[model samples]
Target: MKKHNFYAGPSILSEYTIKNTADAVLNFAGTGLSLLEVSHRGKEFVAVNDEARALVKELLDVPETHEVIFLGGGASLQFYMIPFNLMKKKASYLDTGTWASNAIKEAKFVGEVDVVASSADKNYTYIPKNYTIAPDSEYFHITTNNTIYGTELHKIPEVNIPLVADMSSDIFSFPVDFSKYNAVYAGAQKNLAPAGVTIIIVRKDALGHVDRPLPTMLDYRTHIKKDSMFNTPPVLPIFSALQTLKWYKEQGGIKVLQKKNQEKAAVLYDEIDRNKLFRGTVAVEDRSLMNVCFVMNDEYKELEDKFADFAKAAGMIGIKGHRSVGGFRASLYNAMPIESVKALVQTMQEFEKKH
Candidate 1:
């Protein structure tokens, strides 16, 4: 049976991205050499790097004030790098979930991290509101989407301090006001490409203000100056990202994808709300469009494992929730076709009938 992919990271990829990347892997750019063997310094790979950066800028409408760079480390590295490069006196953070908590942890090692607001009191089920940003804060950090908890910050927080966001799970899912942020970083695994590369779009003038010395590799300036060639980047994932970006543009950019993603989320969420067997995990207002998380209702909780097996048997893969939070999570990334979402809903419905 054909499978519907719902895996979170290293998840679904467009057929266009997959097919083009496969061809390139075998014979890249008609150069008679596989992309795997191509040298980063060579013109062929250099062009790939250049085009990938350009497409990101174009699709995101990234201002000329910012420079986009593809680097090797995941967003996990960026948790430290953000403070290493930006923190002067202290930083402010809004802790919503696991990733945000991790970011706060890393920033503390760099300097003081004032957690202005947090929803950890409620187990991170809702976004904290009406929080104050410290005026002395060097920058404010937030994770736009909580993949594990399935809560998304739909509105960009308005703050005077420079704003930095880790958009690892939800980047490029919709149009963004790029000028609002000093920096936006994400691991490629969720919405862009694979797991090896991380993309950083940093405002050009936001660097060199920090008093502490930054390691050469850790500094954003180092990568910006070298055009992300400070060291050999994650070549394969970068190439795959270029292919995905090309496909994105062909689909009329992120605005179009946002509508499609919304529709997909609505379809599944509606089922979760209407069906008697399951209930959504987070506050309805804060539910994630990219990761739809739900669990069996209290009375039907015993059937959770049976429904999971039923869904899997019906060709729905990766619907299992994260270990920390038990239940089901269907990740509807930019590349996921709506049909797969419907298939998941149907599987849920079929299982509900049996119970």
Candidate 2:
């Protein structure tokens, strides 16, 4: 049976990337040494690190004023690091989903945090539109995409305050106005590479502005000064991320990926809208292209378990939704092929017929 992956994080990667990474794990660049065996400080590894950072800049069109650092710790660490480094007076946050709320919690520990807008009352099923931004706040924070609740901010609102985004789930899935953000961080597991590494792109001018003391590793400047080698980095994930970025560049970067991702989401969403057994969980305008969430109709709710079982039997995996909202979630990242989406739609159609 052919397998299709729809896992959310640590999700599917390009077959080309997987094969090349596997080959490198055995023997990297004909050095007869596995990528795992190489010293991070070696010239070869340094080249890998440098190219990875460069490709990130190219892929995202990050400005010269921005510094891209690939460091350990997931995007979770940045929830605190951003406040510790940037929040001197107060910061504003949009409570879109779990990750955004967590970021707000971390910021409150460092300084005052104002929740400018939130969708919690609606179970984060939609993005809040009408909100006021305080000019005096250090910066406004947002989660670009809500992974658990399958909602996305399609267009970032313009605010006088600098914007900080946690783009862990949707980074590089679409084109972003890099100039509009003061800092952006993402865990590599979703659209970039694998777990064990996080990418931090911060505007250089935003640093050194906070009065709070920071540990050496928590400070972005420390990593920037050492060229992201402040400590031995995650070499394998960085190398794989480099390969993925190279692949992305060859595939025409975010512009091309955005079109493909939209089409992928549309395939499933169209099926959801047309099918009688399923309905979308999020507001149509706020639905995420990365995570397509849906639930069974009231009459078919009793068959939820059966639907999941059938999907599994048909070679579909990870179609289960988040526990916070019960239903089904199909995480279609950049590397997920169009054929996989088609297969999922076919499974949904088949299940609908049976029910």
Candidate 3:
């Protein structure tokens, strides 16, 4: 039986991408050597990197002013790199969750970090609203989706300041106005591909504005000049990411994916609301389409373990919630089959009947 995988990052990928990746692992595109062993600087890998960047621009409708780069060290490196490169003056951040908080910490190390708004008081159950953006601030940073707390900003805020986004969980899951933001970055593991590549799309005008000295690798201009070949890139992951983008394009691109994502979230959220024993964690208006978080009634705490066991026995995996939230979370990314969700809802119904 095919297992229903609901883990958030390094999560499920399309079957076509998986099959192509598997075949390439042994012999890539009729080349004699396995993709895993190919040189990063070779023409084969160069084509892969170039196509991956191009596909991203084409799919997102990124403007001519933007440049896309696939770099190493996940999104964690970007937390520091963004500040180091952009924080010449005061910067503003919206503290939405753990990841956003970490980004604020790194920004403080570089320069003045102003937290314009935060949802920490309510344990990040909703997005904070009605905040002022400083005219003098270098940039305003926001995490588009909160993975741990299961909240998302469906609409990107409009501001005169340069907008920077950490779109790690929801990139390509829906349509985005690429022109509104000065820079956007996402770690590929969640919705794009497996871990190893961090996709950064920055407006060409955003570079060379800061005066701080940067290490060659940390400099955006350095990578831009080299066409993201500043150093040997992650070859296999980039190749796989290209395959995933191709699969996404074949599946009718982001608009179709957005409809599918909304339908998936609606089905799961409807089940959560209809079930008497369960309650959703995030506010209804702010709940995430990617991660659905919920829990049984406090009186039903004794049955938590049994419910989890039952889910596992029925082939549901990674439904366990984060330790901080302590209930259950089902990550419904683009590649997660609708049948898996149907099976999970059926399991929930059966469990409710037993109790």
- Tens digits of lDDT, candidate 2, 188-278: 9999898999999999989998887888988999999999998999999999999899899989889999999999999999999999999
Please give the CA lDDT of all the candidate structures: 0.92, 0.92, 0.90
Question: What would you estimate as the lDDT of candidate 3?
Answer: 0.90
Query: How far off is residue 247 in model 1, in Å?
Result: 0.6
TM-score of 2: 0.99
Query: Could you list the CA RMSD of all candidates, in the order they appear?
Result: 0.8, 0.8, 0.9
Shift of residue 281 alpha carbon in model 2, Å: 0.3
TM-scores of all models? 0.99, 0.99, 0.98
Position 148, candidate 3: lDDT: 89
Q: Candidate 1 vs candidate 3: which has greater lDDT? A: 1
lDDT of 1 by residue, 1-355 (tens): 9899999998999998889889988999889999899889999999999999999999999999999999887999999998888888699999999999999999989899999999999888999988888778878899999999999998888888778999999999877787778899999998999789999999989888988878899999999999999899998899999999999999999999999999999999999999999999999999999999898899998898889889889999998999878899999999999989988888887887777
- Separately for all candidates shown, the number of backbone clashes (residues 3 or more apart, or on different chains) is 0, 0, 0
Top model by lDDT, which number?
2
Off by over 4 Å in 3: none
